[model samples]
Target: MPGFLSLRTKTTSIVALMVAVTMACGGVMIWNTYRVDRLIEGMVSDSVAAYQAAEALETALVNQKGFMSYYVMDRNPEWLQRLGEYRQLFRMRLERAQGFAGTAEERDTLASIGDAYDLYVAAKDKALGLYINGDEIAGGEAHAGVRDQFFKILDHCEAYKKAHEEELFAARQAVHARAEQLRWVTVAALVFVTGLGGVLTLMLGRQVLAPLRRLAREEAGELALMEPNEVKAVTHRIENLIRSAGEAHTELARSRENLLMAEKMVLVGKLAAGMAHSIRNPMTSVKMRLFSLNRSLPLTREQEEDFQVITREIGQVDTIVQNFLEFSRPPRLAMQLESPSTVVDRVLQLLSHRLRSYEVTVEVKREKPLPNVTCDPEQLKEAFVNFMENACKAMGGGGRIVITERVVSETDGAGLAEISFADTGCGIPEEELEQVFQPFFTTREDGTGLGLPISQRIIENHGGWIDVDSVQGKGTTFVVYLPMDSEEKK
Candidate 1:
């Protein structure tokens, strides 16, 4: 059943994707239209540039030939060297004009231009050789025949240039007409594609997401009666729905577990109450009798000190019993606007004695003027104490601990206060990290293991998250991000 549903869903998704892609493709048509216009404009501009270069080269060739003719007619050696430079300029222009010719007619004109160019070069070379050989009179007579042939070649070059220009003009006009036609076609295609996309979006909205959303609601409504197998089946079919449903199931499981824990705590409280009643009277009598004996005894200083030690040990036992009684009873609501910095300071104060004895240093860095957060001050203190105590214990001997407070914004338009506690200690193993947050999970021999879990519950009740990151053999960092209330801001 899951496989069938998955296939159907995938098919629908693919169809919708194709529609979106086709719509995007249509958008490129307008760009194509503009590209065609540019092409036409470029063709005309390039052709004109080519024609101008050709015209300049032809004129330069004529000038160079005229100079060569004068040098030959007069048998002058001065103008010979300058002729080579002018010939180079003419070649450059001819090369440029060669690019503008496309069809057979244009090619034939270029071929004629090439023949004329060769004739000019041959006539100039012959004249220069004769002048160099010191046969001025003979060179002048030979130049007379070559000079007439040179003019005919120049005439042919000019005619070819005129014919090439006409062909380029006609080609430019045809290209412009084709470019306009392509532009209109592209525009029509673009409009049609855009309209197609809107239609596709409308179709998908009507066909896929709406029905899938309804199906999701239906599946959610039937979650409780679902067995593990049923859940697996649904997960295989609808992954997104499965994720949201998993959260709901998790919350339901937590509620059930908490109810069981509360029942167990009630039984423990009853036992604690009975046990206290049995021990309190005897402890009180002993404490009072010891107090009297200490004062009455006129003993040596060492003996008096021994007596004081006995009393102090008894008092410590009493304190432990009292703490147990308090733990059995639930705490009351004591929400207040308290500074996070003050909380960190108080926790540091509580750990001062141990900090000195263990040689552990605690550092606090806070953002200035932090907003107040509404929470039970005592619970917050307990959470911080539990975390700090755990961190200190993890360090084993001595380490640096850092605490910081800052505000952050979440994607949901809610502002949160983020508090971090980090310690340089032997970090938890990757396998053990997740279990560290569970009740009765501990790495220490004598740890109650309830400290972290209870602290987590307290924070969670106030709409906050407690996340842990640890690197084995490096350190651990615990982050608490809690949403802020309106009054807390000020």
Candidate 2:
């Protein structure tokens, strides 16, 4: 189906074309009227010319009368000569009037008028001849007849002139009225066409173009909305990426723990080797003393003193072996509710020798009513020992170590207990800080690099997490977060 404006335009064009054709025909009618009016003008002009010519003829006839009177009354032959000129003038005018007669009827009427004029001329000529022959009564009677006929011809000429002029005027008025009517019709049609065209233009714009434009605008708005939605989709994808990053971080942490366990085993093997090297001389002396004692010789005081030295060396070797075993294979937990402060205090006791040797100052701040945490006693002890030793090592010669324990309320559905170990030592470098908990990645050559990694594992296994804060050349802090006994629900 066609649109509203298209239909309207079709209707309007048809009407306009029809009106234009009709106006054109009206113009043709005006032309025809003009031609008819011209014909009437020609007829009117001929009639007026004929009437003037007839008047000239009448004046010539009067002059001939005067000439005849002079010929008859004074016997002047000159008058007769002049009479011929006057008669010739009157005949020429009569012939010219006859030439103007148009149609046969008009020509017959003009011929009748001409005949009357000829009769007047003939009578005048007769009168002049008679008067010349001295027949006065006959001459006067002929003159009177000629004058009557002359007046009758003149009256006929005037009547035709008046009739033709009236016809011309009536024709001109008819043509003018027709023309005015045509002009008014044409003007009305043009005005109608202009008004229709304007209406159609406005309707077309509103009904067709405007709607298309509105549709375009709506499409643009939809496109604009689509763009933002696409951006939102991109934003959602980005959020998914961030969540993936968090999961990846957790997996990476577990991988690091496994690596740390491997590295710890390697370090243990090396430590065992070093311990063997360190005890070799002690063992040799102990062996030599034992061998000598077995030779069945009497024991001397110096020899016995040597035996005691051997036994003491053996005891030192045993102690070193115990320490190595402890650090090498820390036991898995049989998790239970325990105080974090108690675990930290045990680690401090275990590292007391080195802590004293380095002149390290230590501070312990614990919540008076700290929440109970669930973890293995020995495993937690091992994790704390690693943290304490690292703190002491960072201090180098000496620095303050602050150990704090606090009960944290669940704010975001997580843990409720925290233990913090802070040391005033040269902090780890910013770039290296993230890698500190990675197994086998350490700044110090002597570092096994398993301490932080292992500690992180133990804490995570106990439903906890570890965080580190450090500034190069300043200090380092390690915080262990553990859920309370009641918070194990998490």
Candidate 3:
């Protein structure tokens, strides 16, 4: 709970949890995959080898059985030679089968078959020897007796083969069972990952986006968003902000100054504007005096440190108070015949260098020059500048801004000039739509959150309004609608 409120800490915790869960799922899947593969390999290698060996034993026993009978019938030495070869082949096959036998039961079965074959072979060999010695009667009698033993050996071979078949079948069933188990594991992991992803998304929305949205609405100047560093959230009052008006923004600052210092000041306008101008001048003078004192005055180390703190505090107060006074002051617009499209061109020209630094591109789309409207050109410029700069800040880098100008006809036959500024940047959430034009709503860190409210006020003063439409991840569009001069309506 020490630094628990920090965004970095919360975000790190959320991301780390998601990563841990993902890695755990992945590890299980990988382990299960390896286990299945090993099972399949072992089943094939062990069961298949035993089955093939059993079949070979059967073939060798059958081959030996007929050769001994043939020797007795043909009364030829060639048949006896073949019978001996078959006997050797049977023995070799029996040994191989014994080696392949995976279980003690299988080994015992093979051993029984071996003993039966040995007895059968002994009798067949004796009969063949008698046949070779030309004792036809005795040889035939002995070979006849060997047939029962031979059949017994055949029976043992068949049983051994059958046992191997059953073992192979059992192995196959085991493989299937393992595969099915793998499927369930996979399904469970998928469900877990999906649920984890949902939780991470919710955490991000609650821990990150909600605070950021609130931060945009509040006028807190600096926030400790993370640690050891201060972040300045932008405060935008669109039509007038001179602090962002350095170098490329100089023209914009001058324009806003003109909009504010118009000659036709009256009533509350005169008083508020007079007060702002009065306070601003004295603050500037005080800042200059403090700077001179800081350099020229010499004192003890402790006194010097105290003086520096006071100076910095005063500077902060001056800046904050000036922004507040200007935010509260009534704007005095120098309204005249001005083409908004042309005003946009000047703002682009003025902010060209700044836009380039952000690697942002702006495109203007219009069928033709828009009809002229009565507006304060300076205020319009400042507002357009705010929109463009906000677009640049929204995208962070390398995005497009499209400005479309057109004329729309109202139901009362009056035409309104529509200027749309669309940006390819992270869009605002729909739930916070109402707050986009609130008094101090800005998306940038370096700007005062006064642009939107001031821009809204400036547009309203010209009998116009601003509309915002945004879709998450796609982009946002800000459309300004202003009444065209009656005579110049398209």
Alpha-carbon RMSD to native, per candidate: 12.7, 27.8, 19.7
Residue ranges of candidate 1 with Cα displaced over 4 Å: 1-256, 279-323, 487-490
TM-score of each: 0.46, 0.40, 0.41
lDDT (Cα, tens digit) per residue for candidate 1, span 22-60: 565555655656766676676567666666766876787
Cα lDDT of model 1 overall? 0.74
Q: Find the candidate with the highest TM-score and give its number.
A: 1
How much is the lDDT of residue 207 in candidate 3? 70
Candidate 1 worst ten-residue window by lDDT: 224-233
lDDT of 2 by residue, 139-251 (tens): 89887777777678767766666655665566677767766876777677677767767766776676666665554445445543455444344445557678999999999
Q: What 10-residue stretch in candidate 3 is worst by lDDT?
A: 226-235
- The all-Cα superposition gives candidate 1 an RMSD in Å to the true structure of 12.7
For residue 65, what is the lDDT in candidate 2? Answer: 53
Where does candidate 3 stray beyond 4 Å?
Answer: 1-12, 102-104, 129-141, 201-490
Q: Which segments of model 2 are wrong by more than 4 Å?
A: 1-330, 413-415, 487-490
